[model samples]
Target chain A: MEISELKITIVGLGLIGGSFSMALRELKPKKLWAVDINQDVLKMAETQGIIDRGFLKPNIPLKNSDVVIISLYPEQTVNFIKNNLNNFKRGAVITDTTGIKDKILTEINNFIRDDLEFIGGHPMAGKEAMGFEFASAEIFKGANYILTPTDKNKEENIKLIEKIVMGIGCKNLIKISPKKHDEIIAYTSQMPHILALALVNSNHIDGLGLFVGDSFRAITRVANINARLWAELLIKNKDNILGQIKSFEDSLINIKKSVMEMDSDGLRRIFEKGSDMRDILWRL
Target chain B: MEISELKITIVGLGLIGGSFSMALRELKPKKLWAVDINQDVLKMAETQGIIDRGFLKPNIPLKNSDVVIISLYPEQTVNFIKNNLNNFKRGAVITDTTGIKDKILTEINNFIRDDLEFIGGHPMAGKEAMGFEFASAEIFKGANYILTPTDKNKEENIKLIEKIVMGIGCKNLIKISPKKHDEIIAYTSQMPHILALALVNSNHIDGLGLFVGDSFRAITRVANINARLWAELLIKNKDNILGQIKSFEDSLINIKKSVMEMDSDGLRRIFEKGSDMRDILWRL
Candidate 1:
């Protein structure tokens, strides 16, 4: 299916949804629809010419949409998919932009319409800002887009999704199992947030300005996080996130032991290993 | 007391020394001297007009230098001062640029140079790249320069050091006790390095390229660190760094328990505290 010929409906107007809308706008889809519970956001997006149509509530036109992309908090995304499963087109594709995938995917796949295809996706790009006002299409350029598709998913539907991802300027499309995606992202994404929050909580945070440097700023940049959204993410992916936090704490303990014992060899080994990992990332 | 009239000698032409030289060059000192064991570096700096004179060894002219800045590694800086205490001119303002200060200051202050004054400084700025080639004066522009001065130091000498700091483009000159400096820096600087290293060491790091995101990159950016330099720093500040690492691990454990027990309220509290800290920092 050609990207330009498809009818697309975005079911949120937050940062991810709004940015995705702007990125997809360049393709000039057959009919681009923007849906949000807030009438002001719908009107703003329409005034900005970000979409060809705006809907305050899911209605008949959405049922005939070729693709429906739900961009909401993890739990809200699952609820939206569950509540609107019957309204989706018979052969249309439905996808999501949620960070935690395992629980959301399992719940949505359990009772989703057999006539419709539901694929899980995560555009691994974001800024510290939120809302449609801060959205930019440039965030997706050359960013990694992880797709979690079960074996039951049709190859044509996966290919169509990949085509759309490429059209939106995401050059890296990685296909992995839902469980594998959750496990790796637990380490790469959620562990860093946990560490940042912990570091922030460790200090008298108010007086940190006088003593901080670039290293401190870089490590804690994500500390100014969306608390409600992250709380939902933590609860949904509790098992995997808990495992990562455990491993990370163990690593921190080992480093602390080395420092306390003045074990230069142990400390050096940890640094070398860490540097090796960072070197690989730097090369990439 | 004037910066332009001071005859300055800079030892160890590494990144810190080279950048200090570049920043001081704009002041057009009376006679700028560069000292390094690597004659090639000395020659390069001389050819580039970064220094008026270059020396392969710390000779009598260094002893006569009115102001001598030692930009060597922490251990090397202490050793050099200990070995050449008698050779320094009486009342010469001697200083060092080392990250970990308590041990360095103690050893230097224990020496027999009654007339010479030794002050410890840490310029809170650096780049991953090293050597004189990558040096830039802009690294010190508006950078925080922490000075650790004991009670024995004269007020006039402290003012002189501040003048040099200003001459080098460092607008932030913070006067702090050595112990207080170490305690705060252990949290602000060393803790971040420990966290980044531990995060990098948590996974099969070599295979992390495909699954990583911006948060991972930002958190582990310092993971591409100088192993030997950091090993020395961690060991020297072990007691303080160990305390910080313990507190950080405890914070991580708390967040982990919240996630494992599905305590959303507890998790939200942690996030709110962290965001509060980040907000304070952001305001700075």
Candidate 2:
């Protein structure tokens, strides 16, 4: 499918959705549509030229589309897919930019009409800032683009969606088992937010944190209240994120045990292990 | 005092020393002497042109000079200061570019000669690569240059050292007690490396990481290890680093508890507290 000929519907005109729309526009999709719960945001998205059209709700006419891209939070993504499945054109490929995927995959498998297949996507990109104003097309450049397709997705559907991501300037094409994808992301993506949340709150004694230095500023850069979004998602993907958090917690406890006993050798091992790992990551 | 009139001696001639020398040269210091135990590294430093003159071994004439700087690992920093103390000229201002200071400060306070005090210098600048070849005067530009001067340092001595850091490109001059500096850095600087280390190692499991995607790479980039150097310091400051590790551990356990019980309210409270702290940090 040629970039200019493809029609795109971006559900949820928040940061990810708005930004994805901007990236899609660069590929010059035929018609860019925006959907959001907030009518004011949809209007703003249209005025800002983020999309060619805006919808206050998803159930409105969306038939003029080749692909339906869902960018809602983890908890809302599946239900949003269900609500709008009837509106999509026949054989249209549905995908999402949601952080958690296993749950969403299961929902699509169980709830969506058999005719409409939902391929999963998570362009591993974002920034500290939130909302539509901070959205930009270049955010996807040099970033990983994932395509998760179930048994139901036609081979053509997966390739068409993959072309969209490639045309939008992503660096690599990654196709992984849906379960495997969610497990790794839970560790790298969801858990960091959880840990950042923990780091900020742990030191927040009596609200005297105003004097925090650049260290705290750098570490907890993402801890700000996207509370409704992050909180709901954390609950939805609790098992995997909790496991990642536990592994990190165990590492911390081990280091603490070594330090308290003044066991230099033991502590050194941990640092060595940590450093070796960091070094490997740089190469990758 | 103008930079052209100042005499400077930089010991160890590695990344920190070489970079300091290069930057100070631009500020027009009168004469610079570089010393290192490694003859090859000393030759490399001279060829890199970070110093005007160089030494492979310690010499009395250099020790008797008015100013001496030691830029070595934390373990070697105190010994270097103590070794040069008796042979130095009277009233010579000594300083070091060691990462940690509390223990070094206490050791110097009790052991060093009264008239010649060692003021600590910690320029918060770094890179993944090491050695004089990787050193650039530009690294220190705009970084926070901390001067930890104990009561042992005379007012005149403190002013002179501060002038040198300011002469180089450091923009922020922060004065902090050695204990506080150690405690804060334990959390900010030291702990981040540890976290990066653990994160990288955890991701390296099963060689299955071959398919590891972008978010994993982004989060674990800092894990790359300089094992010999980092292990040495992590051991020396085990107690403080442990305290920080424990605090983070407690946070993870608490979040895990909230998740296990499916307590949405508990999760929100935790997320909100972290968000508030993170938001404020981002503002700055």
Candidate topping lDDT = 1
Q: Residue pairs in steric clash, candidate 2?
A: A223-B275, A274-B197, A275-B225, A278-B223, A278-B224, A279-B223, A279-B224
lDDT of 2 by residue, A178-254 (tens): 77777776766676567667766655233222224444454455565577777676777778777776677667667
Error of 2 at B200 (Å): 1.5
After superposition, the stretches of candidate 2 with alpha carbons farther than 4 Å from their true spots are A1-8, A23-33, A44-53, A57-66, A84-92, A204-218, B1-6, B27-30, B44-52, B204-219, B282-284
Indicate the residue-level lDDT of A282 in model 2.
51
Q: Please give, for residues B1-284, the per-residue lDDT of candidate 2 as tens digits.
A: 56577677888867888788888878777778788878887676668666777887667546646788889888688887777666777778888888788887888777888777789888888777788878888988888888888877889888988888877888778888787777777766676566656665555234334345543454455566466677666666767776777787787778888888878888888887777766665554
- How does model 1 score on DockQ? 0.69
What 10-residue stretch in candidate 2 chain A is worst by lDDT? Answer: A204-213
lDDT of 1 by residue, A1-284 (tens): 88878999999989999999999999998989988988888898889999987898787657869999989998888888788877888798989999888888888889887888889999988888889998999989999999999976899999998998988899799988888888888888888888999998887423455677889989999898888889888888888887787777778888888888888888888999999977776566
Candidate 2 structure, TM-score to reference: 0.88
**Per-residue CA lDDT of candidate 1, range B1-284, in tens?**
78888889999899999999988899988889988999999999999999988887687657778889999988999888887777777789888888888987887788847888998899988899778988999999988998998987899998998998977888789988898888888988888888998887877433555776788889999888778888889899988887787788778888888888888888898898899977876677
Model 1, clash count?
A: 0
Winning candidate number (DockQ): 1
Of candidate 2 chain B, the 10-residue stretch with the lowest lDDT total is B204-213
Q: Which ranges of candidate 1 are over 4 A from the true structure?
A: A205-207, B205-207
Could you give the CAPRI-style class of model 1? medium
